[model samples]
Target: MAAATHAAAGRVSGASTSELGAAPRPAPPAIQRVRRRRRPSGEAPPLPRHLATSGKLWLALSGVVLAVWAVVFVTDSIAYVDVADTRILQAVAEVRSDPLTQVAEVAGGLATSGAIHVIWLVNLVVLVLVRRWRHLFVWLVTGLVVVNLTAVAAAMLQRPRPFEVEIIGRWSGFSMPSLPVTVLATFLVSTLYALVPAGRPREIGKWVVCALLAATAASRLYLAQDHPTDVVTSVVLGVAVPLAAFRLLTPNEVYPVRYRRGRPAHLDVTGARGAAIVRALQDQLGVVATKVAPFALSGSGGSTPLRITVRAHPSAAAEESCVFGKLYAATHVHSDRWYKLGRTLLYGRLEDEKPYHSVRRLVQYEDYVLRVLWDAGLPVPHPMGIVEITPEREYLLVAEFVQDAVEIGDAEIDDAIIDQGLSVVRRLWEIGMAHRDIKPANLLVRDGTLFLIDPAFAEVRPSPWRQAVDLANMMLVLALRTDAARVYARARKQFSDEEIAEAFAATRGLTMPSQLRRMIRAQGRDLHGEFLALLPYQLPPVPIQRWTLRRVGLSLITVAGLALAVAVGVDLVGSPL
Candidate 1:
C-alpha cells in the first residue's frame, strides 16, 4: 500500500518512483574524538599521570634529602646530626654479644660488593633470557650512577664512620648511608621493575622488598657499622633515583615486563583494557562486542590486530559478529615515522613516504581510505569508525572483519580469484590511487573475491612509478598462488603489455614490503624474474635511488643523531658517576 501511494505521489509530483520509494538513511551516531597534541614523529606519547608525577616526586625528594644530609653533617652547619649519630652509635654498640654480632655480621654481608656481583649475574641471565636489552641497560646504568655518586660524595665530605664506637659488623669505604644497604636497595627496585609484571605480584613484591631493606638497615645500625644519618641518606638515594629512571624511560604501558611469546609491539588485549574495549564498543559504536582477541599478529607489526565479536549492531554486515579492529598507540606512531624515514633516506621520497605525526592521524588514514575505496566500488571492509580507548593515547580502527576469509597464500587461488586480484590493481589505476603495500598478507580471498586490507599505506593520485609497483606486487602475490603464465595472462586482460612490462620494471629490491620480501627469499622463489619473463619486452629497470637535497639532509641528520647517541652512551658508561 505504501509503495502504491509512493508511486501515485511520484507520478503526481513528476519525481522518479524509485527515488520516492527509497528509504531515508539513518543518522550516524555521535562519537567523541580525543584532540590531544599530535605527537611529532619520533616523539613518545605523553606519560600517564601517575608515572610522570611519581618520577618528579622521587627526584625532588632525593634532592631535598641529599641537601639536608649535606647541610646537617657534611658541612656541620647543624649540631643535631652528630649528637644523634653518636647516641645512636653508642646505644647500638651496647648489644655487642658474640652470637648477636655474628648474626648481624651475616645479615650485613648482603650489602658487600660481592653480593652486587651475584645480583648482576642473576639479573643478566634473566634479562638475556627474555631479551630485555632496554631494561638491562637501564638497570646497569642506574647501578653505576648510584655507586659512583656515593663514592664521590663520601670522598668530598671525608666523613668518618662513627665517633669512638667499636665497629663489630663489616665496614665499607664511607659511613654516610652504608654503601651495602644503598646498593641492596637500588638492586631491589631495579629487580621489581625489570623482572616482575605489574599488578598484584609487583605490588606484593614491593612490600617484601621494603621489609628486606628495613631488616638490612636495622642490622647495619645494630652492628655499629655506620652513623644513623648515613643509613637514612642512603635509603633516600637508592630508592628514589632508580625508581624515577625506570618509570620515565621504561613505562609499564609502553615497554611492559611481559613474559609473553609475542613481540612487544603487540599490546595486551586482556585485563582492564580488554574489558574497556568491550564497553566502549557497546556504548559508542553500538557494537556489543562479546569477545576481543589479538588476531593474526605475525603480519601486523605497527598496530595490534584485533578480532572483535559483535553481539548486535544496526549494520547487517556486523550481524555475524565479524568486526576487525587495529589498536593504535604511541609506539605504532613512532614506528610508522621511523619506517618512512628509513625509506626516505634509502629511496629518496618514493611516492608517499611521509610519516604520520600522530597515532590518531595514522589510523584515520586507514579509516578514510576504507571509506573512499568502498565508495569507489572496490572490495574492502565497511569502515566502522574509530573508537577512542585511551582518549588520544590509544584508539581502535573498527571495520568489517571479513569472517571465514583466508589469506590468498593459504587459500585455493583459482582463475576467478586471480582475475579478481588483477582487476583490483586495474581499478586502483583507474581511480588514480595506490595500495602502496600490496602483498600476500594484505590480500585475502573470500568466496572468489579478492580483498585488500591494511590501507594505512594507501595514497591517492600516486606517482606512475608507485602505481606500477602496485601492479607488480599484486602479480607477484597472485603468481605465487598459481603459475606465472596464468596470472600474467589474466593481468594482460585489464592491463596492456606495455603496462605489464612497466610494472615489472618498477618492481625490485626495496620495492616490496618486508614480509613479502622475506617470504620470497625463504621460499627461494624468483617470482620477480618469472613475471618479467612473461612480459612482452622488458623496459629498462626503474631507478629507485633518486638522491635529492631533502634525502641528503635527512641522511646527514640521521647519521649525526646516531653519532651523538653513541657519544652520550659512551660518556655515561665511562663516567665515574
Candidate 2:
C-alpha cells in the first residue's frame, strides 16, 4: 500500500525520482528558429588589419623617400657635382680610350639589352594569358610603338647636342631620342606595375625606379653613345608610352583635379550685373565671393555716343580683365545685324558721307589703328575698351578721356599750339609713322599743350613721301580754320618753305576730285592768297584755275538775276505813268 502511493504521487507531480518506470519527457519540439535582423544593403565591409597596417607603413616609407630626395637635391646643388652631361662625357672618353674599358662597355650593352627585352616579353605574355583583355593589350602595344617611332624620328632630326663631342668611340645615330634611354624607361615602368604592391610604398618604389631608369639613360649619353636630347627623348617616350597604355586599358584610372594656387578664389561684384557675374564665376570656380562693384563706364560706337557699364573679375591682384561692350545707335530694322555709331558729333560728316554697312568691323579696324599709334608712342587717347555697334552702325571706343584737353576746333591757335603740332609731326617722322586723317577733331589742346588724336588712319612704315603727305594733310586741315599766314609763319619757324613745298607736292599725288578742290579753293581764297604771299612761290596753277572758275560762275549768275529784276521794275513804272 505504501509503495503504490509513492508511485502514484511521483506520476501525478511529474517529478523524476529514481523510479523503476517513468514516461520520458517528449524531446522539446525541434526549436522553431527566430529570424535574424537583415543588414542594410551597400554597407562597407570592415577593413582587414593587415591592409591597414601595410598602408601606414607605406606612408612612412614615402615620407622618408621624399625627405631623402630633397636632401640629395640640395647637397648636389651645393657641392657643384658635375652629374650631368659633362660628367658622362668624361666617363665615356675614359672608357673608349682605354683597352680594358671594353669590358665595361660590353656589360652596359648587355644590361640594357636584358632590361629592354625582358619587360616587353613579360608584358606580352601576361596580356596573352588574360584572354578577354585584347583591348588593353592593343592599346599598350600601339602606344609603345608610336612613342618609339616618334623618338626615332625626332632623333633623326639631329638637333645639336648640349655637350661637346668627345668621340672616343664611333657614334652613328642622331643626338636626340636616345634609344637606350627609352628602353630603360619602358622597362622600369612595366616592371613597377608587375611587381610593386599597390599602396604609398608602391608609389615611392615607382618613383625610385623611374629615377634609376633616368640615371641609366643619362649614363649612355655621358658615355657618348647618344646625345643628351636623344637620351631625354628616349626617357619621355618610355614613360609616355606605358602610361598612355595604362590609361587606355583602365579608363577609370583617370583622376582629374583643377589646381588653383595663387589665383583668386572669390567672386568680385561691383553692381547688380556684377553680382550675377560673380555668382556664375563662383559656381564655375567653386570659390567664395570677396567683393562687388559696378563695372567701369566706357564709350560705345554710334552717331550718338552710347555709354556702357560692365563688371569684371580680375585674374589676380595685379592683372586686368578685358571686357568688350556693345551700343546701338538706333532701333532701325535695316539689316539682320546690330549696328553701332560713334557718339561724338565729330562723326556726323562720316555718317552722312560713307556707306552705312558693317560699322562694327570698321570700328574694330579703327581700334587696331589706335593700338598701332599707341605702340608708336603718339599722343592718342589710351584705349581701354571697345564698343561694337550693329552691322549698320559705327562703334564707340572707350578710351582714357583726356579730362583737360581742348579740341583744336574749340581752341585758339597760338605759337604754343603751332610749335607743339610741328613737334608732333617731327616725332611721327622719327618713328616712321603717318597719321592719314589729320583734322581739327583729331587734334587736342590741353593748357596750351597740343596732342595728336584720332590715329585711326595711322600707318607705320619707312616712307618719307607718305610722311610728307601726312604733314601736308595736317597743314591743310589747319589752314581751313586758321589764317594761312599765321599757320605758315608758325610752320616755317620749324620747317623750310622748300620742305613745305615738297610736302604739298607729295600731297598733290593723292586722289582729290576736281569738284572737291574747287569747293575748297572757293572757301579758302583769302586764306590761300595770304599763305602764298608769305611763301617763296605763288599758289599752284590748278588751285588758281578752280578759284577763278568759281568766282566767274558766281558773277555771271548775279548779273543775269539783276537784269531780269530791272526789266520787271521798268514795266511796273510804265503801267503807273
Question: Which candidate has the highest lDDT of all?
Answer: 1
Could you tell me every candidate's TM-score relative to the true structure?
Answer: 0.78, 0.32
lDDT (CA) per prediction: 0.76, 0.46
Candidate 2 lDDT over 429-485, as tens digits, reads: 666677765656567677766666555446667366667666666665566557677
lDDT string for model 1 (1-577, tens) is: 6576445434433432222221111222223222223335664322222456656777788899877866676566646677788898888788778888778777776677666667766886899898786797788789877877777788877777776787766665767656676778888899999999998999999998888788778788887777887788888889898898888677777668989688767998887678878767765666667789999999888889999766544444444355789998876776678778987887788767777787778778889988888777677877888877765567889987776779888899887777777767767776789999898889887766677789878999989999999988988888776888888887655666777888889989788988888878887889898888777578999898888999999999999987875665454334331
RMSD of 1: 10.0
Candidate 1: stretches off by over 4 Å: 1-49, 52-77, 97-160, 167-184, 199-208, 215-219, 222-225, 313-320, 337-351, 518-524, 545-577
lDDT of 2 at 287: 23
